[model samples]
Target: MIRRLIFAFISIAISITIASSIKAAETIRPNVLFIAMDDLNDWIGCMGGHPQTITPNLDRLAKSGVLFTNAHCAAPACNPSRISVFSGIAPNVSGVYANNQVLREVLPDVELLPKSFSKNGYRSTGSGKMLHYIIDAQSWDDYFPEPASEMPIPHTLYPDKRPVSLPRAGPWQYVETDWGALETTDQEFGGDFTVSQWVSEQLAQKHDNPFFLACGIYRPHEPWFVPAKYFEPFPLESILIPPGYKEDDLADLPPEGQRQGPNRYFAHIQKQGQWKHAIQSYLASIHFADAMLGRVLDALDNSEYADNTIVVLWSDHGWHLGEKQHWQKYTAWRVCTRIPLMIRVPKNCPGLPEGTSSGICNQPVNLVSLAPTLFDLCGLPPSKVHDGPSLTPLLKDVDGQWPHVSVTCLHNPGDYGLSDNRWRYIHYANGDEELYDIAADRYEWNNLAADPKYADKLAELRAKGPTSFASKPEPSIQSLNKLTWVTLGDDKAPPSRPDGSQFPVFFINQSEAPVKLYWVDRMGQPKFYEEIQPTKTARQATRPGAIWQITNLQDKPLGYFKVDDRSAQAIIPAH
Candidate 1:
C-alpha cells in the first residue's frame, strides 16, 4: 500500500508540472501586429527607390527594426502573392499564379497564417483588403466591418465621375488606372483611414488572449484617389520620370521580352501627356498610406502590449512605373519583384532572447517565409508542411550565415525570376532567358544572357529554380463576371478587333441546348471555333478587343461577349 501511494503521488505531480509549464508558455507567446500595403514598391524614404517619394512612418518603422532591402514577393500579382504569404506555399506549388485565381478553390485544405495562430491560442482579426479584396472569412476569429460582407474594406470617397484625371483611350484601358486627388479630409474620405481607426481601437483595448491583428492599407494600388492634402508635396512640374526608364531598354531583350514590353496602357498614358501627372498621384497615395500607418503605430505605443508584441510590415508585391518598358506589374523584372519587408521584435522573445537589432540586411528573402518565421518567434510548434524555411536565424542576427535565394513566379507556370545576392536570372517556359548583374545595373538596362561570359552563372541560378510546376487550376464559371447578353433581334454581333497579347477565355454554356461558338473575324464574318454543350465550358485563345459569338444548333443568333485584356469566363445564359 505504501509503494502504490508513492507511485500515484509521483504521477499526479508529473501531470501538474506539465500543465503548469504549458500554461506559462501560453502566457509569454508574443502577439503579432501584421501590416500589409498594396502595390507599394521600394519607393519609400528608407529604400530611396524614388528620390522624390516621402514616407515618414515607413522610415520610422525601419529605424526601430530589421529592414530587408532585398526582399521579394513569391508572385508579382495581388492574389498569388498574398496567398503565398498566408499559406506559406509558393505560387508554383499552389498553382495560383494570377489575380483572377481564387485562393479557396486552389487550396481549400491549407491552413492560413491567421488560422494557424487562432488554432494555437491567439485571436486572429483583420480589416481592409487582406486577401485579394475578399476577407478569407473562415481564417479569422473576428474581423472589422464583419466577415459576412466578404469585403473587409470600409467606404472611401472616389470621384463621382470615373477616369477623373486620365481619360480612357478605349475599351482596352483598365478603368482603375486613372489617378487624382479628392477634395476631402482623411476622416471624411474613410476607406483605409477607417480601417486604421478600427485597428487602432483594437490595439488600445485589453484582450482575453494574444491577438494576431492585421491592418491592410490599400493605396498606391490604383485610382490614386486620396485627400488633396496628400498631393501638395508632389507637384506635377517637379515630378521626374522613373529613374529605371530607358528609351531603348527593350533592344537587348529576347523576343518574348520584346513582345511583353511596350504595352498599350503605357503607350496611351504617354500619348495623353499624363505620365508626370500619374507619377505625382502615385507619390501622393504612398504618403497617404504612411500617415495611416502612423495612427496604428501610435496606438500600439500607447497600449500595454507595446513591448511584448511582434510587428511586421510588408507589401503584397512591387509596382512598375514604366520600368523595363512596362507600365504595371506581371513582368519578370526587379522593379516588379522587390518589396519592402521589416520586422521589429520586442525584448525577451521566445525565438530571440535579446530581440532583433535595428539595421538593414541585403540578403535575398521571400515573403513566403513569413508564416514559419512567426511560428518560431511565438514559440508555437514547428510545422513541416510550410514550403518556406523559418527566418528566425535572420531575425536573431541580421548577418547570420544564410544560403537561400528569393524566387518570384510569373503568371505562367515554368516562368520565374530568381534573385541571389548579386545577380537576377529570368527563365521562361519557351527556353528564353534574361540575365542581369543587378548589383552593378540596378535598373536592369542591360541583358547579359546573350553574353558567353555569364553562361556558367546563368546555369547555376537555373538549377536552383522550381523543377516541376503544378497545373494551374481553373476557377469556376460562377465566380467570373457575367458578360452582357444580346438576343438576335436586339443587336448584331460586333466585329473582332484583336489587339495586344493573347490570353485564354473560357465560354461556359448555361443554356439547356448546345450552343455553337464562333469567332467574329475582323470583317464581321463568323468563323466556327467549336461547340460547347450545356453545362460545359470551352477554353479559347483570344486577345483584347476580340469578339466571340454564340448561336443555337439551328444557327439562330443568341449573344456575344467582347474579350478584354485578361482571362475571363463568359456565360451563355439560358433563354
Candidate 2:
C-alpha cells in the first residue's frame, strides 16, 4: 500500500509540473502589434523627407525602437508589395508585379503571415486595408466589422463630387488622384479612425493566447481628403514643392528612365496651378493618418500587454508627389521604393532577451524579411519558403553587420532597382540601365551608368540581382475589364469585324429580366448565342473587334458592346 501511494504521488507531481511549464511558456510568449501605413514615404519628422510633414506619433514610435533608415519595399506597387510583405515571397518569384493581378490566383497555396501565426497557436486579427482592397478572411481568427464582409474597411466619408481640387487631365488619368480637405471631424470621417477604434478595443482586452494584431491605416494615399483640422497646420501659402524636383533631372537618364519620367498628370497639375494645393492636402492627409496611429498606440500603452507586446510599424510602399517628375507609385526610384520601418521588441522575447534599444540602422533591407523576423522574435518556427533573411540581428543591435542588398521589382519581370549602402542601380527590361551614387545625389539627379570608371561597380550590382524571374501569370478570364454599354436607340448594332487574338469576355446580366445574347457578325445581323438569367454571368469567346448585343426577353434591343483588344466584362443595364 505504501509503494502504491508513493507511485500515485509521483505521477500527480509530474502532471502538475508539466502543466505549470506549459502555462509558463504561454505566459511569456510575446504579443505582436503589427501596424501598416499605405503610401506613406519617409515624410515623417523622424526621417525628414519633407519639412512641412507633421508626424509626432511616428516620431515617438521611432524614438522607442530600432528604425531602419535604408529599408525598401520588395515591390513598388501596392498589390505586389503587400503580397510580398505578407507572404514572405518576392514579386519576381511569385509573378505578381502589378495591382490588377489577383493574389490567390497567382500563388494559391502560399500561406500568409497571419495564417502562419494562427497555425502556431496565436490569435491573428486585423482591421482596415491589410491587403489590396481586401481583408482575406480565412487567414485571421477574427476581424473588425466582421470577417465575412471580406473588406476590412468600415464606412468612411468621401467627397460627394470628385475632382474637387485637381481637374481630370484626361480619360487615362486615375480618378482617385485628386486632393482636397473635407469639413468633418475624425469621428465623422469614420474610415481609418474606425479601424483605430476597433484595434484599440482589442488591445484593451486580455487574450487567452498570444495575439498578432494588425492595424492598417489607409491615408496619405490618393484623393487626400481628410478633416479640415488636419490642414490647419499646413497653410496653402506655406506649402512647398518637393525639393527633389528638377527641370533637367531626366537629361542623363536612359531611354526607359527618360520615358517613365515627365508624366502627363504632373504636367496637368502644374498647368492648373494646383501643385501647392495638392501638397497641402497630402500633408493634411498624413497628419490625419498620424492621428489615427496615435489612438492605437495610446490604447496599447494603457493596456495590460504594454510591456510584453512587440510593436512593428511599416508602410506598403512610398508615394511620389512630383519626385523624379512622377506623381504616384509604380516606380523603382527611392522616392517610391523607400519606406519607414520600425520595430520595438519588449524584454523576455526569444530573439532578444535584453530587448531592443532605440537607434537607427542604415543597412539596406527589404520588407520581405518582416515575416521571418516576427517568427524569430515570437519564438515560432521560421517559414521554410521565406526569400529574405531574418532581421533579428539588426533588431538586437542597430549597427549589426548586414550584407543584404535590397531589390525592388518594377512593372515587369526583368526590370528592378537595386540599392545598397551607397549606390542605387536601376535596370529596365529593355536593357536600359541607370546608376546613381545615392550618397552624393539623394534625389537621383545624375545617372552614372554611362561612365566607364563605374563599369566594374555596375557589373557587381547586376550580378547581385535575381538570376531567374518567373514569367508573369496569364490573367484569368474574370479579369476586371470594364466595357461601356451603349444603349440601343433607333440604330442597329455595329458589325463584328472579329480580328486579333481570341480571349474570353464575361457578360454579367445585371438587368431585372433575362436578356438574350447575340453576336453581331460582319453582316450586322444578330446571331443568337444563349439566354442569360437575371443576376447571372456568362463567358463568351471573342476577338478584338467582335460586337456583342443584349436584348430583352421579347427580343427588344437593350444595349450593345464593342470589344476592345482585351478580354472584358459587359454588364447588361437594368431598365
TM-score of candidate 1 to 2 decimals: 0.90
Model 2, span 1-575: residue lDDT tens: 99999999999999999998876764477999999999998899999899999999999999999999999999988899999999999999889898878888898888999999999889999998889987778888999878998777799999998878888754446778888878888999899999999999999887998899999999987879999999999999989888787777878888888787778788889899988998898889999999999999999999999999999999999988897788888888999999999999998887777789989999999999998999898888877889998999998777878888999998789999999999999999899998889899998988999999999999999989888888888667565778999999889998887755687889999888899999998999999999999999999988877889999889988889988766688888798
List all candidate RMSDs to the true structure.
3.9, 5.4
C-alpha TM-scores of all predictions: 0.90, 0.87
Q: What is the alpha-carbon lDDT for the whole of candidate 1?
A: 0.89
* Model 1 lDDT tens row, 1-575: 99999999999999999998976754588889999999999999999899999899999999999999999999999999999999989898899998887888889888998999999999999988889988978999989778988987899888888878789776577879999988999999999999999999999898999999999999888978999999999988899998888888988999888876778778888888989999999999999999999999999999999999999999998888887667888887889999999999987678766788898888899999998999889888887767888888988778888899999999899889999889999989999999999889998999999999998999999999889998898777666666566566667797988876787878989889999999999999999989999999998888888888899998788889988767788888997
Single out the weakest 10-residue window by summed lDDT for candidate 1: 477-486
Backbone clashes, candidate 1:
0
Task: Quote the lDDT for 491 in model 2.
Answer: 92
lDDT on C-alpha atoms for all candidate structures: 0.89, 0.89
Q: Which stretches of model 1 miss by more than 4 angstroms? A: 1-27, 486-498, 504-541, 546-560
Clashing residue pairs, candidate 1? none
